[model samples]
Target: MNQRNSTQLHPPTRHFSVLLSPTPRGARLARLLATEWLRTWELPHHATEAAEHLVAELAANAATHGRLPGRDFRLALLAGSETLRVEVTDTRGDDLPHRRPATPDGESGRGLLLVEALSDRWGVELGPVPRKTVWAELDLSPEFGNVCSGGSGALLQETREGKKPHQAPPLPPTEPAHSRE
Candidate 1:
Protein backbone atom coordinates (compact mmCIF):
# COMPACT_ATOMS: atom_id res chain seq x y z
CA MET A 1 0.00 0.00 0.00
CA ASN A 2 1.08 3.59 -0.60
CA GLN A 3 2.19 5.69 2.38
CA ARG A 4 -0.96 7.80 2.15
CA ASN A 5 -3.18 4.72 2.26
CA SER A 6 -1.22 3.33 5.21
CA THR A 7 -1.70 6.51 7.20
CA GLN A 8 -5.41 6.72 6.38
CA LEU A 9 -6.23 3.71 8.53
CA HIS A 10 -5.39 5.62 11.68
CA PRO A 11 -8.01 7.78 13.35
CA PRO A 12 -7.78 11.53 12.96
CA THR A 13 -6.23 13.39 15.88
CA ARG A 14 -6.92 16.78 17.39
CA HIS A 15 -4.76 18.64 19.89
CA PHE A 16 -4.97 21.64 22.23
CA SER A 17 -2.17 22.91 24.41
CA VAL A 18 -1.73 25.90 26.68
CA LEU A 19 0.67 27.18 29.30
CA LEU A 20 -0.75 28.86 32.37
CA SER A 21 0.45 30.17 35.70
CA PRO A 22 0.73 27.39 38.22
CA THR A 23 -2.04 28.59 40.45
CA PRO A 24 -5.53 27.61 41.54
CA ARG A 25 -7.03 29.76 38.83
CA GLY A 26 -4.97 27.98 36.21
CA ALA A 27 -6.12 24.61 37.44
CA ARG A 28 -9.77 25.62 37.19
CA LEU A 29 -9.19 27.10 33.76
CA ALA A 30 -7.66 23.83 32.63
CA ARG A 31 -10.88 21.99 33.37
CA LEU A 32 -13.07 24.64 31.78
CA LEU A 33 -11.01 24.82 28.61
CA ALA A 34 -11.03 21.07 28.31
CA THR A 35 -14.80 20.93 28.56
CA GLU A 36 -15.21 23.59 25.91
CA TRP A 37 -12.86 21.84 23.54
CA LEU A 38 -14.70 18.56 24.02
CA ARG A 39 -17.99 20.26 23.30
CA THR A 40 -16.54 21.61 20.06
CA TRP A 41 -15.53 18.08 19.18
CA GLU A 42 -19.07 16.92 20.12
CA LEU A 43 -17.78 14.37 22.58
CA PRO A 44 -20.38 12.54 24.61
CA HIS A 45 -21.36 13.85 28.03
CA HIS A 46 -19.68 11.00 29.88
CA ALA A 47 -16.47 11.49 27.95
CA THR A 48 -16.50 15.20 28.63
CA GLU A 49 -17.14 14.77 32.35
CA ALA A 50 -14.45 12.13 32.71
CA ALA A 51 -12.01 14.26 30.77
CA GLU A 52 -12.84 17.25 32.95
CA HIS A 53 -12.29 15.32 36.13
CA LEU A 54 -9.02 13.92 34.92
CA VAL A 55 -7.78 17.32 33.82
CA ALA A 56 -8.89 18.95 37.07
CA GLU A 57 -7.06 16.44 39.20
CA LEU A 58 -3.94 16.63 37.08
CA ALA A 59 -3.94 20.42 36.82
CA ALA A 60 -4.60 20.82 40.54
CA ASN A 61 -1.81 18.45 41.32
CA ALA A 62 0.53 20.39 39.08
CA ALA A 63 -0.43 23.70 40.62
CA THR A 64 -0.10 22.44 44.17
CA HIS A 65 2.66 19.88 44.24
CA GLY A 66 4.66 20.67 41.16
CA ARG A 67 5.02 24.37 41.78
CA LEU A 68 8.35 26.02 41.23
CA PRO A 69 8.75 29.78 41.54
CA GLY A 70 8.40 31.55 38.19
CA ARG A 71 7.68 28.37 36.35
CA ASP A 72 4.42 27.70 34.55
CA PHE A 73 2.61 24.45 33.91
CA ARG A 74 1.25 23.22 30.59
CA LEU A 75 -2.06 21.53 29.91
CA ALA A 76 -2.50 19.48 26.76
CA LEU A 77 -5.47 17.58 25.40
CA LEU A 78 -5.13 15.07 22.59
CA ALA A 79 -8.49 13.92 21.30
CA GLY A 80 -8.76 10.84 19.15
CA SER A 81 -11.80 8.88 18.06
CA GLU A 82 -11.39 6.26 20.77
CA THR A 83 -9.67 8.15 23.56
CA LEU A 84 -9.12 11.58 25.02
CA ARG A 85 -5.66 11.94 26.56
CA VAL A 86 -5.20 14.73 29.11
CA GLU A 87 -1.74 15.85 30.15
CA VAL A 88 -0.41 18.41 32.62
CA THR A 89 3.29 19.03 32.37
CA ASP A 90 4.93 20.72 35.31
CA THR A 91 8.43 21.73 36.29
CA ARG A 92 8.92 19.20 39.03
CA GLY A 93 10.58 16.19 37.54
CA ASP A 94 11.60 14.57 40.80
CA ASP A 95 8.20 14.64 42.42
CA LEU A 96 6.11 12.03 40.70
CA PRO A 97 2.53 11.40 41.77
CA HIS A 98 1.74 8.30 43.74
CA ARG A 99 -1.70 7.12 44.79
CA ARG A 100 -2.28 5.74 48.23
CA PRO A 101 -5.38 4.59 50.01
CA ALA A 102 -6.76 7.54 51.92
CA THR A 103 -8.23 7.22 55.38
CA PRO A 104 -11.98 7.80 55.40
CA ASP A 105 -11.56 10.96 57.40
CA GLY A 106 -8.45 12.18 55.67
CA GLU A 107 -8.76 15.57 54.05
CA SER A 108 -6.12 15.07 51.37
CA GLY A 109 -4.28 12.64 49.06
CA ARG A 110 -7.36 11.35 47.25
CA GLY A 111 -6.94 13.15 43.95
CA LEU A 112 -4.91 10.45 42.29
CA LEU A 113 -7.48 7.91 43.38
CA LEU A 114 -10.15 9.86 41.54
CA VAL A 115 -7.93 10.00 38.47
CA GLU A 116 -7.37 6.26 38.68
CA ALA A 117 -11.07 5.63 38.90
CA LEU A 118 -11.97 7.87 36.00
CA SER A 119 -9.21 6.97 33.56
CA ASP A 120 -8.75 3.79 31.60
CA ARG A 121 -4.99 4.37 31.70
CA TRP A 122 -2.80 6.95 33.45
CA GLY A 123 0.91 7.59 34.06
CA VAL A 124 3.73 10.09 34.24
CA GLU A 125 6.52 10.84 31.80
CA LEU A 126 9.76 12.51 32.74
CA GLY A 127 11.21 14.94 30.24
CA PRO A 128 14.35 16.48 28.73
CA VAL A 129 15.11 18.27 31.98
CA PRO A 130 13.24 19.51 35.04
CA ARG A 131 9.86 18.59 33.55
CA LYS A 132 7.30 15.90 34.06
CA THR A 133 4.00 15.20 32.39
CA VAL A 134 1.16 13.52 34.26
CA TRP A 135 -1.34 12.02 31.90
CA ALA A 136 -4.67 10.19 31.97
CA GLU A 137 -6.92 8.87 29.25
CA LEU A 138 -10.67 8.28 29.13
CA ASP A 139 -11.98 5.76 26.66
CA LEU A 140 -14.73 7.11 24.39
CA SER A 141 -15.57 4.30 22.04
CA PRO A 142 -17.89 2.63 24.49
CA GLU A 143 -20.51 5.30 23.93
CA PHE A 144 -19.52 6.86 20.63
CA GLY A 145 -18.32 5.37 17.37
CA ASN A 146 -15.28 6.54 15.37
CA VAL A 147 -17.09 8.34 12.56
CA CYS A 148 -16.69 11.62 14.39
CA SER A 149 -12.93 11.45 13.97
CA GLY A 150 -13.21 13.69 10.87
CA GLY A 151 -11.23 11.33 8.70
CA SER A 152 -12.30 9.54 5.58
CA GLY A 153 -14.76 6.71 6.22
CA ALA A 154 -11.86 4.32 6.82
CA LEU A 155 -10.74 4.40 10.46
CA LEU A 156 -9.21 2.43 13.28
CA GLN A 157 -11.68 1.17 15.86
CA GLU A 158 -10.11 0.34 19.22
CA THR A 159 -13.07 -0.83 21.28
CA ARG A 160 -14.31 -4.36 20.76
CA GLU A 161 -17.16 -4.25 23.32
CA GLY A 162 -15.91 -7.22 25.39
CA LYS A 163 -12.20 -6.64 25.09
CA LYS A 164 -10.05 -5.14 27.84
CA PRO A 165 -9.20 -1.47 27.92
CA HIS A 166 -6.30 -0.35 25.77
CA GLN A 167 -2.81 0.04 27.11
CA ALA A 168 -1.47 3.55 27.63
CA PRO A 169 -0.10 5.00 24.42
CA PRO A 170 3.47 4.21 23.56
CA LEU A 171 6.04 6.82 24.53
CA PRO A 172 6.79 9.44 21.91
CA PRO A 173 8.74 8.00 19.05
CA THR A 174 12.49 7.59 19.31
CA GLU A 175 15.17 6.64 16.85
CA PRO A 176 15.19 2.91 16.25
CA ALA A 177 18.10 0.90 17.58
CA HIS A 178 19.86 -1.25 15.05
CA SER A 179 20.12 -4.96 15.81
CA ARG A 180 23.44 -6.73 15.46
CA GLU A 181 23.12 -10.27 14.20
Candidate 2:
Protein backbone atom coordinates (compact mmCIF):
# COMPACT_ATOMS: atom_id res chain seq x y z
CA MET A 1 0.00 0.00 0.00
CA ASN A 2 2.92 2.25 0.59
CA GLN A 3 3.87 1.66 -2.99
CA ARG A 4 2.54 3.99 -5.62
CA ASN A 5 -0.93 3.17 -6.86
CA SER A 6 -0.38 5.26 -9.97
CA THR A 7 1.94 7.92 -11.25
CA GLN A 8 2.25 10.52 -8.48
CA LEU A 9 1.76 13.87 -10.12
CA HIS A 10 3.94 16.66 -8.75
CA PRO A 11 2.72 19.89 -10.25
CA PRO A 12 5.28 22.56 -11.15
CA THR A 13 4.21 25.36 -8.79
CA ARG A 14 2.87 23.48 -5.75
CA HIS A 15 1.11 20.31 -4.57
CA PHE A 16 2.62 16.92 -3.75
CA SER A 17 1.49 13.56 -2.46
CA VAL A 18 3.20 10.34 -1.39
CA LEU A 19 2.04 6.80 -0.94
CA LEU A 20 3.00 4.88 2.18
CA SER A 21 2.44 1.42 3.56
CA PRO A 22 -0.65 0.59 5.58
CA THR A 23 1.22 -0.91 8.50
CA PRO A 24 1.45 0.68 11.94
CA ARG A 25 4.96 1.77 11.15
CA GLY A 26 3.68 3.21 7.92
CA ALA A 27 1.07 5.17 9.82
CA ARG A 28 3.70 6.59 12.12
CA LEU A 29 5.91 7.40 9.18
CA ALA A 30 3.01 9.21 7.52
CA ARG A 31 2.70 11.64 10.40
CA LEU A 32 6.45 12.17 10.60
CA LEU A 33 6.81 12.76 6.91
CA ALA A 34 3.80 15.08 6.80
CA THR A 35 5.25 17.25 9.55
CA GLU A 36 8.49 17.59 7.64
CA TRP A 37 6.70 18.26 4.38
CA LEU A 38 4.49 20.91 5.90
CA ARG A 39 7.39 22.68 7.53
CA THR A 40 9.31 22.64 4.29
CA TRP A 41 6.33 24.13 2.46
CA GLU A 42 5.99 26.86 5.07
CA LEU A 43 2.43 25.80 5.78
CA PRO A 44 0.67 27.36 8.67
CA HIS A 45 0.98 25.46 11.95
CA HIS A 46 -2.74 24.64 12.11
CA ALA A 47 -2.84 22.99 8.71
CA THR A 48 0.03 20.71 9.62
CA GLU A 49 -1.56 19.93 12.98
CA ALA A 50 -4.82 18.92 11.35
CA ALA A 51 -2.95 16.84 8.80
CA GLU A 52 -1.06 15.03 11.56
CA HIS A 53 -4.23 14.17 13.45
CA LEU A 54 -5.94 13.04 10.28
CA VAL A 55 -3.03 10.85 9.29
CA ALA A 56 -2.82 9.29 12.76
CA GLU A 57 -6.52 8.55 12.95
CA LEU A 58 -6.91 7.31 9.41
CA ALA A 59 -3.74 5.27 9.53
CA ALA A 60 -4.68 3.78 12.88
CA ASN A 61 -8.04 2.87 11.43
CA ALA A 62 -6.29 1.34 8.45
CA ALA A 63 -3.96 -0.74 10.60
CA THR A 64 -6.61 -1.80 13.09
CA HIS A 65 -9.67 -2.06 10.88
CA GLY A 66 -8.75 -1.98 7.21
CA ARG A 67 -5.62 -4.08 7.30
CA LEU A 68 -5.06 -6.95 4.92
CA PRO A 69 -1.88 -8.89 4.76
CA GLY A 70 0.40 -8.11 1.82
CA ARG A 71 -1.53 -4.97 1.16
CA ASP A 72 -0.54 -1.37 1.89
CA PHE A 73 -2.02 1.96 2.92
CA ARG A 74 -1.13 5.28 1.37
CA LEU A 75 -0.68 8.80 2.72
CA ALA A 76 -1.24 11.62 0.29
CA LEU A 77 -0.72 15.33 1.02
CA LEU A 78 -1.74 18.01 -1.43
CA ALA A 79 -1.35 21.72 -0.82
CA GLY A 80 -2.94 24.52 -2.82
CA SER A 81 -3.02 28.26 -2.40
CA GLU A 82 -6.02 28.38 -0.08
CA THR A 83 -6.23 24.88 1.27
CA LEU A 84 -4.28 21.73 2.01
CA ARG A 85 -5.68 18.27 1.45
CA VAL A 86 -4.70 15.16 3.42
CA GLU A 87 -5.77 11.76 2.27
CA VAL A 88 -5.11 8.30 3.72
CA THR A 89 -6.06 5.50 1.40
CA ASP A 90 -6.26 1.88 2.43
CA THR A 91 -7.15 -1.25 0.50
CA ARG A 92 -10.09 -2.17 2.68
CA GLY A 93 -13.21 -1.92 0.64
CA ASP A 94 -14.99 -4.64 2.55
CA ASP A 95 -15.77 -2.51 5.57
CA LEU A 96 -16.36 1.19 5.44
CA PRO A 97 -16.18 3.26 8.62
CA HIS A 98 -19.36 4.14 10.45
CA ARG A 99 -19.90 6.48 13.32
CA ARG A 100 -21.34 4.44 16.12
CA PRO A 101 -22.91 5.86 19.20
CA ALA A 102 -20.56 5.44 22.11
CA THR A 103 -22.36 4.69 25.33
CA PRO A 104 -21.44 6.12 28.67
CA ASP A 105 -18.21 4.57 29.96
CA GLY A 106 -17.47 3.12 26.52
CA GLU A 107 -13.80 2.70 25.99
CA SER A 108 -13.64 3.33 22.24
CA GLY A 109 -15.09 4.88 19.05
CA ARG A 110 -15.24 8.50 17.81
CA GLY A 111 -12.54 9.01 15.21
CA LEU A 112 -14.68 10.58 12.54
CA LEU A 113 -16.09 13.07 14.99
CA LEU A 114 -12.65 14.47 15.53
CA VAL A 115 -12.13 14.53 11.79
CA GLU A 116 -15.37 16.41 11.32
CA ALA A 117 -14.39 19.00 13.87
CA LEU A 118 -10.87 19.51 12.65
CA SER A 119 -11.15 19.61 8.89
CA ASP A 120 -13.11 22.14 6.86
CA ARG A 121 -14.34 19.28 4.71
CA TRP A 122 -13.82 15.49 4.70
CA GLY A 123 -15.16 12.34 3.10
CA VAL A 124 -14.24 8.85 1.90
CA GLU A 125 -13.59 8.12 -1.75
CA LEU A 126 -14.23 4.67 -3.19
CA GLY A 127 -11.93 4.33 -6.14
CA PRO A 128 -10.82 2.56 -9.30
CA VAL A 129 -9.45 -0.45 -7.41
CA PRO A 130 -11.68 -1.02 -4.40
CA ARG A 131 -9.56 1.23 -2.21
CA LYS A 132 -10.84 3.86 0.20
CA THR A 133 -9.30 7.29 0.43
CA VAL A 134 -10.40 9.26 3.46
CA TRP A 135 -9.54 12.89 2.86
CA ALA A 136 -9.66 16.08 4.86
CA GLU A 137 -9.02 19.65 3.79
CA LEU A 138 -7.57 22.38 5.96
CA ASP A 139 -8.22 25.93 4.86
CA LEU A 140 -5.21 28.21 4.75
CA SER A 141 -6.13 31.62 6.05
CA PRO A 142 -5.40 34.45 3.62
CA GLU A 143 -2.60 35.77 5.76
CA PHE A 144 -0.57 32.68 4.95
CA GLY A 145 -0.05 32.80 1.15
CA ASN A 146 2.67 35.38 0.75
CA VAL A 147 4.55 34.10 3.75
CA CYS A 148 4.37 30.51 2.60
CA SER A 149 5.31 31.27 -1.01
CA GLY A 150 8.23 33.49 -0.14
CA GLY A 151 9.21 31.49 2.88
CA SER A 152 9.39 28.14 1.11
CA GLY A 153 13.12 28.47 0.42
CA ALA A 154 13.92 29.44 3.98
CA LEU A 155 11.71 26.71 5.30
CA LEU A 156 13.40 24.05 3.24
CA GLN A 157 16.75 25.42 4.32
CA GLU A 158 15.66 25.20 7.94
CA THR A 159 14.56 21.64 7.42
CA ARG A 160 17.93 20.86 5.86
CA GLU A 161 19.70 22.53 8.75
CA GLY A 162 18.71 19.67 11.04
CA LYS A 163 15.75 21.37 12.62
CA LYS A 164 13.27 18.72 13.67
CA PRO A 165 9.92 19.49 12.14
CA HIS A 166 7.38 20.62 14.70
CA GLN A 167 4.21 18.63 15.24
CA ALA A 168 0.71 20.13 15.54
CA PRO A 169 -0.09 22.07 18.66
CA PRO A 170 -2.04 20.32 21.39
CA LEU A 171 -5.83 20.62 21.46
CA PRO A 172 -7.47 23.54 23.16
CA PRO A 173 -7.70 23.52 26.95
CA THR A 174 -10.69 21.50 28.11
CA GLU A 175 -12.54 23.73 30.55
CA PRO A 176 -12.62 27.18 32.03
CA ALA A 177 -13.24 27.95 35.68
CA HIS A 178 -16.38 29.82 36.66
CA SER A 179 -15.98 33.39 37.80
CA ARG A 180 -16.45 33.91 41.53
CA GLU A 181 -18.28 37.20 41.74
Candidate 3:
Protein backbone atom coordinates (compact mmCIF):
# COMPACT_ATOMS: atom_id res chain seq x y z
CA MET A 1 0.00 0.00 0.00
CA ASN A 2 1.23 3.49 -0.80
CA GLN A 3 2.17 5.46 2.30
CA ARG A 4 0.10 8.43 1.12
CA ASN A 5 -2.99 6.29 0.68
CA SER A 6 -2.75 4.46 4.00
CA THR A 7 -5.47 5.46 6.46
CA GLN A 8 -4.72 6.73 9.93
CA LEU A 9 -6.91 7.57 12.89
CA HIS A 10 -6.61 9.59 16.05
CA PRO A 11 -9.16 10.10 18.76
CA PRO A 12 -10.46 13.59 19.32
CA THR A 13 -9.16 15.64 22.21
CA ARG A 14 -12.13 17.11 24.00
CA HIS A 15 -12.66 19.77 26.61
CA PHE A 16 -12.74 19.00 30.32
CA SER A 17 -12.31 20.61 33.74
CA VAL A 18 -11.80 19.75 37.40
CA LEU A 19 -12.07 21.31 40.86
CA LEU A 20 -9.62 20.64 43.69
CA SER A 21 -9.05 21.88 47.20
CA PRO A 22 -6.84 24.87 48.13
CA THR A 23 -3.74 23.36 49.66
CA PRO A 24 -0.08 22.77 48.79
CA ARG A 25 -0.82 19.13 48.18
CA GLY A 26 -3.79 20.09 46.06
CA ALA A 27 -1.54 22.34 43.99
CA ARG A 28 0.87 19.48 43.37
CA LEU A 29 -1.98 17.16 42.51
CA ALA A 30 -3.34 19.70 40.07
CA ARG A 31 -0.11 19.62 38.06
CA LEU A 32 0.01 15.84 38.07
CA LEU A 33 -3.64 15.47 37.09
CA ALA A 34 -3.31 18.05 34.34
CA THR A 35 -0.28 16.29 32.89
CA GLU A 36 -2.10 12.96 32.80
CA TRP A 37 -5.27 14.45 31.36
CA LEU A 38 -3.41 16.34 28.65
CA ARG A 39 -1.58 13.20 27.69
CA THR A 40 -4.93 11.47 27.22
CA TRP A 41 -5.92 14.34 24.93
CA GLU A 42 -2.75 13.70 22.90
CA LEU A 43 -1.17 16.99 23.77
CA PRO A 44 2.49 17.07 22.70
CA HIS A 45 5.39 17.13 25.12
CA HIS A 46 5.93 20.90 24.96
CA ALA A 47 2.28 21.70 25.51
CA THR A 48 2.04 19.20 28.32
CA GLU A 49 5.11 20.67 29.98
CA ALA A 50 3.78 24.19 29.63
CA ALA A 51 0.41 23.16 31.03
CA GLU A 52 2.08 21.51 34.01
CA HIS A 53 4.13 24.58 34.80
CA LEU A 54 1.18 26.93 34.46
CA VAL A 55 -1.01 24.72 36.62
CA ALA A 56 1.62 24.52 39.31
CA GLU A 57 2.08 28.28 39.43
CA LEU A 58 -1.63 29.07 39.46
CA ALA A 59 -2.44 26.37 41.97
CA ALA A 60 0.39 27.52 44.21
CA ASN A 61 -0.91 31.07 44.05
CA ALA A 62 -4.38 29.89 44.97
CA ALA A 63 -3.06 27.87 47.86
CA THR A 64 -0.93 30.73 49.12
CA HIS A 65 -2.57 34.06 48.43
CA GLY A 66 -6.13 33.11 47.67
CA ARG A 67 -6.97 30.59 50.33
CA LEU A 68 -9.87 31.01 52.73
CA PRO A 69 -10.26 28.76 55.76
CA GLY A 70 -12.27 25.63 54.97
CA ARG A 71 -12.83 26.78 51.40
CA ASP A 72 -11.23 25.00 48.47
CA PHE A 73 -9.83 26.16 45.16
CA ARG A 74 -10.78 24.93 41.71
CA LEU A 75 -8.70 23.98 38.68
CA ALA A 76 -10.35 23.78 35.28
CA LEU A 77 -9.00 23.04 31.81
CA LEU A 78 -11.10 23.90 28.79
CA ALA A 79 -9.94 22.93 25.33
CA GLY A 80 -11.26 24.97 22.44
CA SER A 81 -10.93 25.08 18.67
CA GLU A 82 -7.65 26.97 18.84
CA THR A 83 -6.87 27.42 22.49
CA LEU A 84 -6.86 25.88 25.97
CA ARG A 85 -8.02 27.93 28.92
CA VAL A 86 -6.71 27.08 32.40
CA GLU A 87 -8.61 28.51 35.32
CA VAL A 88 -7.77 28.48 39.03
CA THR A 89 -10.43 29.84 41.32
CA ASP A 90 -10.15 30.44 45.05
CA THR A 91 -12.33 31.71 47.87
CA ARG A 92 -10.45 34.86 48.75
CA GLY A 93 -12.33 37.52 46.86
CA ASP A 94 -10.67 40.28 48.81
CA ASP A 95 -7.17 39.29 47.75
CA LEU A 96 -7.29 40.26 44.12
CA PRO A 97 -3.99 39.72 42.26
CA HIS A 98 -2.19 42.51 40.55
CA ARG A 99 1.16 42.97 38.89
CA ARG A 100 3.68 44.46 41.26
CA PRO A 101 7.39 45.01 41.21
CA ALA A 102 9.26 42.00 42.45
CA THR A 103 12.14 42.72 44.75
CA PRO A 104 15.51 42.17 43.12
CA ASP A 105 16.81 40.09 46.00
CA GLY A 106 13.53 38.45 46.94
CA GLU A 107 12.80 34.82 46.18
CA SER A 108 9.11 35.48 45.63
CA GLY A 109 6.58 37.03 43.23
CA ARG A 110 7.61 35.05 40.15
CA GLY A 111 4.50 32.93 39.74
CA LEU A 112 2.55 35.61 37.93
CA LEU A 113 5.62 36.34 35.88
CA LEU A 114 5.79 32.78 34.71
CA VAL A 115 2.07 32.76 33.97
CA GLU A 116 2.32 35.90 31.83
CA ALA A 117 5.20 34.44 29.86
CA LEU A 118 3.43 31.19 29.11
CA SER A 119 -0.13 32.26 28.36
CA ASP A 120 -1.54 33.97 25.31
CA ARG A 121 -4.01 35.82 27.48
CA TRP A 122 -5.04 35.91 31.13
CA GLY A 123 -7.42 37.72 33.43
CA VAL A 124 -9.48 37.61 36.60
CA GLU A 125 -13.19 36.98 37.12
CA LEU A 126 -15.43 37.85 40.04
CA GLY A 127 -17.79 35.17 41.24
CA PRO A 128 -21.19 34.84 42.93
CA VAL A 129 -19.92 34.11 46.43
CA PRO A 130 -17.01 36.39 47.16
CA ARG A 131 -14.79 34.24 44.97
CA LYS A 132 -12.27 34.98 42.23
CA THR A 133 -11.07 33.08 39.19
CA VAL A 134 -7.73 33.66 37.48
CA TRP A 135 -7.38 32.13 34.07
CA ALA A 136 -4.59 31.65 31.55
CA GLU A 137 -5.21 30.71 27.93
CA LEU A 138 -2.75 28.71 25.84
CA ASP A 139 -2.85 28.17 22.10
CA LEU A 140 -3.21 24.50 21.24
CA SER A 141 -3.68 24.42 17.47
CA PRO A 142 -0.01 23.87 16.73
CA GLU A 143 0.44 21.19 19.35
CA PHE A 144 -2.64 19.28 18.23
CA GLY A 145 -0.97 18.45 14.96
CA ASN A 146 2.00 16.86 16.69
CA VAL A 147 -0.24 15.49 19.42
CA CYS A 148 -2.66 13.90 16.99
CA SER A 149 0.37 12.37 15.30
CA GLY A 150 -1.27 13.08 11.96
CA GLY A 151 -2.03 15.89 9.60
CA SER A 152 -4.81 18.23 10.69
CA GLY A 153 -6.25 18.60 7.21
CA ALA A 154 -7.79 15.16 7.34
CA LEU A 155 -9.22 15.78 10.75
CA LEU A 156 -10.68 19.04 9.58
CA GLN A 157 -12.25 17.28 6.65
CA GLU A 158 -13.73 14.66 8.93
CA THR A 159 -15.03 17.33 11.26
CA ARG A 160 -16.44 19.30 8.35
CA GLU A 161 -18.31 16.21 7.26
CA GLY A 162 -19.87 16.02 10.77
CA LYS A 163 -17.99 13.15 12.29
CA LYS A 164 -17.37 12.96 16.00
CA PRO A 165 -14.00 11.66 17.19
CA HIS A 166 -13.73 9.32 20.15
CA GLN A 167 -12.61 10.67 23.50
CA ALA A 168 -12.26 9.63 27.12
CA PRO A 169 -15.46 9.58 29.10
CA PRO A 170 -16.09 12.16 31.77
CA LEU A 171 -14.45 11.40 35.07
CA PRO A 172 -16.63 10.28 37.95
CA PRO A 173 -16.78 12.54 40.99
CA THR A 174 -13.87 12.04 43.39
CA GLU A 175 -15.80 12.85 46.51
CA PRO A 176 -15.99 9.74 48.71
CA ALA A 177 -19.38 10.11 50.38
CA HIS A 178 -22.77 11.35 49.32
CA SER A 179 -24.22 12.81 52.49
CA ARG A 180 -27.50 13.64 50.78
CA GLU A 181 -27.89 10.01 49.79
> What is the TM-score of each predicted model, taking all chains together?
0.74, 0.66, 0.67
Query: Best lDDT goes to which candidate?
Result: 1
For model 2, what is the alpha-carbon lDDT of residue 107? 54
Q: Candidate 3 on 1-181: residue-level lDDT in tens?
A: 6566666765444766677778889899889998888888776565566778889999999998998778888888877555667889998877777555689998678777777566545667777668988887655654322332112212221222343333312223431211100
Error of 2 at 17 (Å): 3.3
Worst 10 residues of 2 by lDDT: 149-158
Best by TM-score: 1
- Per-candidate Cα lDDT values, in order, are 0.75, 0.65, 0.67
Q: After superposition, how far is residue 2 of candidate 2 from its true place, in Å?
A: 52
| Model 1, position 157: C-alpha lDDT score | 31
Arrange candidates by lDDT, highest first: which order?
1, 3, 2
Per-residue accuracy of model 1 over 90-171 as CA lDDT, tens digit each: 9998887766468889977888767766666776778958999988876676533433221111143344554655454344
Q: How high is the lDDT of residue 60 in model 3?
A: 93
Off by over 4 Å in 2: 1-13, 101-107, 142-181
Candidate 2 residues 1-181, lDDT tens each?
4875698665443565676666778778877988888889887886777778877887778877878888888777888766687888888866667665777788558676666656655666676577877777665663322233111121212232353333332222442211110
Residue 43 CA error for candidate 1 (Å)?
Answer: 0.9
Q: Which residue runs of candidate 1 sit more than 4 Å off their true CA positions? A: 1-11, 100-103, 143-181
Angstrom error of the Cα, residue 26, model 2: value is 1.7
